[model samples]
Target: MAEKKAYPLRIGADVLEAMQRWADDDLRSLNAQIEYVLRAQLRQAGRLRPPVPTPAVEEKE
Candidate 1:
Protein backbone atom coordinates (compact mmCIF):
# COMPACT_ATOMS: atom_id res chain seq x y z
CA MET A 1 0.00 0.00 0.00
CA ALA A 2 1.16 3.53 -0.71
CA GLU A 3 1.61 6.05 2.05
CA LYS A 4 -1.40 8.32 2.61
CA LYS A 5 -0.92 12.07 3.09
CA ALA A 6 -3.49 14.24 4.76
CA TYR A 7 -4.47 17.64 3.37
CA PRO A 8 -6.99 20.17 4.53
CA LEU A 9 -9.94 20.59 2.18
CA ARG A 10 -12.41 23.45 2.12
CA ILE A 11 -15.81 22.30 0.85
CA GLY A 12 -19.34 23.47 1.02
CA ALA A 13 -21.66 21.99 3.65
CA ASP A 14 -24.10 20.66 1.01
CA VAL A 15 -21.34 18.93 -0.91
CA LEU A 16 -19.94 17.30 2.21
CA GLU A 17 -23.42 16.08 3.19
CA ALA A 18 -23.96 14.58 -0.25
CA MET A 19 -20.60 12.84 -0.11
CA GLN A 20 -21.39 11.45 3.32
CA ARG A 21 -24.63 9.98 2.02
CA TRP A 22 -22.88 8.43 -0.96
CA ALA A 23 -20.12 7.04 1.26
CA ASP A 24 -22.74 5.48 3.53
CA ASP A 25 -24.47 3.82 0.58
CA ASP A 26 -21.19 2.48 -0.75
CA LEU A 27 -20.06 1.25 2.72
CA ARG A 28 -16.82 3.21 2.47
CA SER A 29 -15.20 5.90 4.55
CA LEU A 30 -15.80 9.50 3.39
CA ASN A 31 -12.13 9.91 2.44
CA ALA A 32 -12.21 6.61 0.52
CA GLN A 33 -15.39 7.59 -1.27
CA ILE A 34 -13.88 10.93 -2.27
CA GLU A 35 -10.72 9.27 -3.59
CA TYR A 36 -12.78 6.65 -5.45
CA VAL A 37 -14.86 9.28 -7.20
CA LEU A 38 -11.80 11.34 -8.08
CA ARG A 39 -10.02 8.33 -9.53
CA ALA A 40 -13.05 7.32 -11.57
CA GLN A 41 -13.37 10.80 -13.02
CA LEU A 42 -9.68 10.92 -13.79
CA ARG A 43 -9.90 7.63 -15.69
CA GLN A 44 -12.90 8.88 -17.62
CA ALA A 45 -11.03 12.05 -18.54
CA GLY A 46 -7.91 10.10 -19.54
CA ARG A 47 -5.92 11.67 -16.76
CA LEU A 48 -5.25 8.33 -15.07
CA ARG A 49 -4.70 4.85 -16.42
CA PRO A 50 -6.62 1.77 -15.36
CA PRO A 51 -4.84 -0.64 -13.08
CA VAL A 52 -3.08 -3.60 -14.62
CA PRO A 53 -4.09 -7.12 -13.65
CA THR A 54 -1.63 -9.32 -11.73
CA PRO A 55 -0.81 -12.78 -13.12
CA ALA A 56 -1.91 -15.77 -11.08
CA VAL A 57 0.87 -17.96 -9.71
CA GLU A 58 0.49 -21.75 -9.82
CA GLU A 59 1.07 -23.56 -6.56
CA LYS A 60 2.74 -26.90 -6.31
CA GLU A 61 0.66 -29.71 -4.86
Candidate 2:
Protein backbone atom coordinates (compact mmCIF):
# COMPACT_ATOMS: atom_id res chain seq x y z
CA MET A 1 0.00 0.00 0.00
CA ALA A 2 1.18 3.51 -0.68
CA GLU A 3 1.46 6.20 1.95
CA LYS A 4 -1.41 8.68 2.03
CA LYS A 5 -1.20 12.42 2.49
CA ALA A 6 -3.72 14.51 4.38
CA TYR A 7 -4.93 17.87 3.15
CA PRO A 8 -7.63 20.21 4.30
CA LEU A 9 -10.55 20.65 1.93
CA ARG A 10 -13.19 23.36 1.84
CA ILE A 11 -16.55 22.10 0.68
CA GLY A 12 -20.00 23.59 0.80
CA ALA A 13 -22.22 22.32 3.59
CA ASP A 14 -24.88 21.04 1.21
CA VAL A 15 -22.33 19.19 -0.92
CA LEU A 16 -20.75 17.61 2.14
CA GLU A 17 -24.12 16.48 3.42
CA ALA A 18 -24.99 14.96 0.06
CA MET A 19 -21.64 13.20 -0.06
CA GLN A 20 -22.18 11.87 3.44
CA ARG A 21 -25.50 10.39 2.39
CA TRP A 22 -23.93 8.86 -0.70
CA ALA A 23 -21.12 7.40 1.37
CA ASP A 24 -23.61 5.83 3.75
CA ASP A 25 -25.59 4.37 0.87
CA ASP A 26 -22.41 2.87 -0.60
CA LEU A 27 -21.15 1.60 2.77
CA ARG A 28 -17.98 3.69 2.41
CA SER A 29 -16.36 6.33 4.53
CA LEU A 30 -16.73 9.91 3.28
CA ASN A 31 -13.03 10.10 2.36
CA ALA A 32 -13.13 6.79 0.50
CA GLN A 33 -16.27 7.80 -1.36
CA ILE A 34 -14.61 11.05 -2.42
CA GLU A 35 -11.53 9.19 -3.61
CA TYR A 36 -13.65 6.71 -5.54
CA VAL A 37 -15.52 9.50 -7.28
CA LEU A 38 -12.31 11.29 -8.18
CA ARG A 39 -10.66 8.13 -9.44
CA ALA A 40 -13.64 7.32 -11.60
CA GLN A 41 -13.56 10.77 -13.09
CA LEU A 42 -9.85 10.51 -13.77
CA ARG A 43 -10.31 7.16 -15.47
CA GLN A 44 -13.10 8.58 -17.63
CA ALA A 45 -10.83 11.42 -18.64
CA GLY A 46 -7.93 9.03 -19.40
CA ARG A 47 -5.82 10.69 -16.76
CA LEU A 48 -5.39 7.65 -14.51
CA ARG A 49 -3.87 4.34 -15.52
CA PRO A 50 -5.81 1.13 -15.20
CA PRO A 51 -4.76 -1.22 -12.43
CA VAL A 52 -2.54 -4.12 -13.41
CA PRO A 53 -3.64 -7.62 -12.63
CA THR A 54 -1.43 -9.93 -10.59
CA PRO A 55 -0.54 -13.41 -11.78
CA ALA A 56 -2.20 -16.28 -9.98
CA VAL A 57 0.05 -18.59 -7.96
CA GLU A 58 0.09 -22.33 -8.66
CA GLU A 59 -0.84 -24.68 -5.82
CA LYS A 60 1.34 -27.69 -5.14
CA GLU A 61 -0.48 -30.88 -4.27
TM-score of each: 0.86, 0.89
RMSD of each: 1.2, 1.0
Residue 43, candidate 2: Cα error in Å is 0.4
Candidate 2, residue 39: Cα displacement in angstroms equals: 0.4
lDDT per residue as tens, model 2, 1-61? 4588998999999999999999999999999999999989999999998888888999999
Q: After superposition, which runs of candidate 2 have C-alpha atoms over 4 Å from their true positions?
A: none
Candidate 2 RMSD to the real structure: 1.0
Clashes of 1: 0
lDDT of 1 at 61: 100
TM-score winner: 2
lDDT of 1 at 9: 93
- TM for candidate 1 is 0.86
